[model samples]
Target: MSATIKDVAKMAGVAVSTVSYALNNSPKISEETRRKVVRAAEALNFRPSGAARNLKKRKSETIGLFLNDLGGPFYSQVIEGVQEIVASHDYNLIVCSTYGGENSSAHRFLREKFVDGAIIMGTAISDSLILQVASESFPIVVLDRELRGDYVHNVLITNEQGGYDAVAHLIKLGRRNIEFLSGPSAAFDNTQRYEGYKRALLEHDLPVPKRIAMHGRFLEAGGYQAVKLLLASKRLPDAIFAANDEMAIGAIRALHEAGLRVPEDIAIVGFDNINLAPLIRPALSTIGHSKFEVGAIATQLVFNARKEEDVIILPTQLIARQSCGFSGGVSEQDHDNLVASILHVGGRTKH
Candidate 1:
């Protein structure tokens, strides 16, 4: 049989009300008496029910972290940032990937008020649903998308600027025939990035080759397949700008297998500056931002008491490596030394 609060009170030689106050850390009880009650409860192996405590306090002290999918290295750093902030705030975080937004668990948790708030990063959950559920009592913070509601806040990266900088760097390297490997058509980030790419090309009076603009789906395999299709067409561009680093790496592998060299035959640039970008051969020249900061800031917004809708846009910077053939007229050794020096000086390049 399980020990009850009465048993703890009896064991500690205290009244039932005194036991309650002690266990709940009420100021009405002395510290010494609270310690005594706690010791008795521990000795009796009395575990307080979380559901009961939540009901009494009317606060779950938990938050939900919703993602599109859990199978990428990109999410790990973001999760770390969220976890750090949530822990510091004395709240538990539940991570759920909706896998295209059909996750019953996510739906249940949100509807049932199992969490105090949610930090949502996936697109599967419709904006209508978020708007319906978000109230002043149940605030929500959305990442990567712009959502406006009384209780909703948005945290997003400057994806358009990142995309523009990436393409502009390629154009500055004298590559006019630049191809863009796009991500999913439904993704807002992809749309913004493509818009930026188009804007840069238009500014430079470069032709936007509609035929070469292929979808990479933001995956390595997608990039590889897209490159294969481009090769099959027998019409290659002077350079390619993949929407993400994973696609860029995949394109590099595919180009190498087809007896083409990067930055010589076809220069390449990518966005997202993922961890593997620097480690890869002919290190990726890409747009970089702190995914960790994005996660942390989003989580913080969820906890904020401001009822008005707000938007936070994080900035991004361009990271130049060897892949884009922009050595600035320096020798290969000198360029490498310069890159090392930049890294040592704490520039945007990832370690």
Candidate 2:
């Protein structure tokens, strides 16, 4: 790894600022100290970054993207889309995870104004913190969360409608006793999806049993455990609607472990048509949206200086596949057709 200024400072037995002064040939530093710093830097093959130096004086011309975790495939397309927009404008992208809430690096980045703007998707960072950091000079675009401020913009999905569609599709497949595999209760998307599930069941005159709703915490492991719990009770629903693809995948694993057949014994549907959805056995039926478009639009809105508050609501689409016993399932060629007719509803911007 390349040596930093701190390494030079430590080698020279001086403060970091002192080493900075010596390297920059400042009058404040003694000749002996300057030579000492230079010799240490040379020994470590250290070189300072001009762009980083310039950041101390003015705008960094970088965009920060904050997320809860960086492990899943869901972030891949979103990051790619953000990078596309960022690279086009000759700007840099810095991705940070807010795993530790305010104590994490994300908070430091926002508080210090190291980046020119931010695109936040993590719920760990509080709304007050975002509001505190955002201004005319530092624009912010948040995903899937609601907040109103002078320079803050929102990009949201039709989560409730997507949830409704998933349940309605199951209903069409003759799945009356449907179970809901929920994500975190605090999550806006989770809450909205749960609402849609209830709405669909009520409209269909089906029993919205509390016992059927299981917490999957939006994780594969969580989904697996949730289904195991239901299996332990010796009462399983005819169908299940997972809030996200990860949980649905996990549930499938659990069902297989129990020697149960998908769709034949219990139908399943999931949200977020991730890349693996089609590859899985009995191709997963899911609620689909343009994750790439969400990231691209959020990046575009980072530079958007609107006089009024801006909230962009993207549309959702239902993908039919064999998992729900809906059809033969989506072929590799039909993956592009995931958007379907629902996309015609179009996205709208609210002020």
Of the candidates shown, which would achieve the greatest lDDT relative to the real structure?
2
> TM-scores of all models?
0.84, 0.81
lDDT of 2: 0.86
Clashes of each: 0, 0
TM-score of 2: 0.81
Query: lDDT tens string, model 1, 171-258?
Result: 8889888898988888888888888889999999987876545788888888998998898889898899898888898899989999
Please give, for residues 1-351, the per-residue lDDT of candidate 2 as tens digits.
899999999999999999878877899999999999999999999988878666554778789999998878798888987998899998899999998877888889999988989999968988998889888788999998988998899999999999998899888878898999988889999889988999999999998886545788888899999999988888888999999998999999999899999989999999998999988998888988888878888898897755356899887778888888865434434646544333345345454
Residue 341 Cα positional deviation in candidate 2, in Å, after optimal superposition: 11
Question: Runs in model 2 with CA error above 4 Å?
Answer: 1-53, 327-335, 338-351
State, as a TM-score between 0 and 1, how close model 1 is to the true structure.
0.84
